[model samples]
Target: MKTILIPVDFSDTNTNAIKYAADMGCDMPVKKIILLKSYYTSVYEQILPSPDFLLISADDIENERQKIEVQLKELMKKLKNRCHENIEIETVVSTEPIVRAIHNVVEDQHPDLMIVGGDMGHELSMIGEQIIEIAKSSPVKVLVIPPDCNYHKIEQALVPCDLEAVARLGVLKGLNTSHSWLNPKLMLLYVDPKKKHIGREAEFEASVKQLVNCYECKLHYSEDKNIVRGILNFATEQQVQLIIALPGKHSFFYNLTHSSITEALSLNARHPVLILK
Candidate 1:
């Protein structure tokens, strides 16, 4: 809630995500936003035969760094203009690979959240392909913004949960701290492919009770052969603006393996998906 870290490739997908973060930063308790760009020489580029004169030099790398810095500055300026004057805007250019760059930034910034752009339909963009890895690996929570998704007030949020593993829901305990920024009515959904039910599990009910005390929340159940479809269908029907994915079997990476479900979410999702560790 205080700081957000966003890695950019300067693609349209990333641009939209930056804009979304800016809008949300203005509304939330964000104090700073860091834009990161990574630069690295690929193995192919390093090993391929080339004229000695044509080989990349220190000057070439310096020029490339300057160019990326300029781009980052431009984006930072745009965010500054869009967000509240009090919010700080910063940029980082790294000479490491994108994943490592992100890790380094996360270590250095300790951001409250990391936001990344994703396109799950057809072919995955480079950033899109890395979304799951980043979310799973990041110590901080991550928000995945679908391509072209604009900012909207999150009045309602749907959390597709695996009720059998209520312990994983502890990741959401932090939400209680951001109540004003989100202020969403929480819908905790348990989807059973075999049409099973939560039968008098005292511990499970206790966990749900604790969540109710944390936020204005309700527990719901659904029966569907396809879990991903069930979650998306419920989100759409309820008109929720955010979907929170907790770690473990019900995470995005688990569901993204199904191409059909991935495309379904890519095509139908209008809001961002928050991945909590």
Candidate 2:
């Protein structure tokens, strides 16, 4: 991975993700890190008056943008201390919506990865609430760092998947070519909730092995009524440092039955979850 894009909202959750990215970049072949902040004015903010109950002037908006730029630059300086001197860091302040701003950056720069924070509390920041949407829509891979997750050497990663959609494993081939720094052992987990797909385990293993030949991968089968719980339990037992989520018909996001469960997994996972497109 050569470049990483991170959108900052100045929340405690976002601050943690920024630090995590800085630390992770040191280990990867990362060359540049882009810090983006969106200053888009919502309809309510434009219509509602300030504390003085009067519409803010254009100068006030420019002043706010300047202040945000200063903060972004300060963050870049701190990240530089955490990264190797060779790594280049840049900042971008935009007036477009957060999603649109990210899309423009991706189109122009084609970053290898995007990192975001996952909020675990009910009081979610606007950016935090949109994390899943961003991951789903982003053309590049996205690594989500939970509020309490700390950076650690990624020695092993768990991939909970449906073997029927073996085509999705094709993306894993890039792990060796594009992100050689992330050479962690892989564990492909199949949660057979109803035990209906019993005899096809070996067949699926053969298919998965064919696709992920570049890495050390092992296939595992689990039995549980709740797929989310099953995946979490196995991850805890194996002590994996990351969870690889594939998006497709049998994707991680699809398996998550409800918004609440999705939030629970994304926001509470002890290890970071990498959503691959």
Candidate 3:
């Protein structure tokens, strides 16, 4: 993990993500933390222009930049002091849309990860979906932190395995490769259908076991129809602090309701969800 680019709207809601990034930087090889603020003229501001609306000059833009810079600096200071060790802190204030701004940041910084604060209890709001869409498309990993959940030691985390992708792509193989995973004990949840099909269950389970054998892992199987809810239930029951998911490729799980399950779990996560791509 070299760089983490965090896009903030300068709202109090996202402060948690900012702090979370700082906490992560403490132990990881996180070299840089870029705090970005994307701003634009609002609809109300356009309709009710300032005193010199018609003759708006460069001064207005500079003033806005300075304001955002000040805010970013404050956040930068807070994060810098939070960590016991030193890491680079940068502040970027952009006038582009939030989503586009994020892409631009990623293009420029090439961050290893992106983190954002998410709301709880319902499906992703419009803005949340846009943040998630960026995650879905980004080659880098994206970690979505829930609003109410505080950052603590990640003791145990859950990983849902359909036993297909992990076999073909070795997605789970890279689980411990990243320093950010913190080597938490992993729980692999496999929810099989109540009605069995004549597939290679034994072979699949064997493959799954081989990948997880190096790390402490517990295997689980569920017969629930709603796989998304089933996974979330297990997460809550086990008191897991994290869930790791990879972006989709055409596989058995993807064909069997990919968007619905992945979107629901990532967007409406009760625990912090890390989307590894």
RMSD to truth, every model? 3.0, 1.9, 4.4
Clashes of 3: 0
- Higher-ranked by lDDT: 2 or 3: 2
lDDT tens digits, residue span 1-277, model 2: 8899999988888988989988887787889999999999876777789798988667878999999998998888888998878889988898999999999999988899999988777455667888767877889898888888889989999998888788888888887786676888999998887775688877887898899988899999898877777888898899999999887768766556559545555645597988888
Number of the top-ranking candidate, with TM-score as the measure = 2
Give per-residue CA lDDT, model 3, range 1-277, as digits (tens).
Answer: 6788887765444787788878877767788888878776655665575787664446776887888888878888888899646589888877777777778888888888888876443543433546545666666777888766677777798877666566533665565676444578888777666635236667766776786665677767777787777778888899998887645753322334535744564545468888766
At residue 34, give the lDDT of candidate 3.
Answer: 89
Arrange candidates by lDDT, descending: 2, 1, 3
Residue 152 of model 2 has an lDDT of: 92
Between candidates 1 and 3, name the one with more favorable TM-score. 1
For 93-173, candidate 1 gives per-residue lDDT tens digits of 888888888889988888878898877544545676666567667888788888867898888999888776777777676
Candidate topping lDDT: 2
- Best first by TM-score, ranked: 2, 1, 3
Q: For model 3, state the Cα shift of residue 158 in Å.
A: 0.9
Ten residues in sequence with the least summed lDDT for candidate 1 = 252-261
Give lDDT for model 3: 0.70
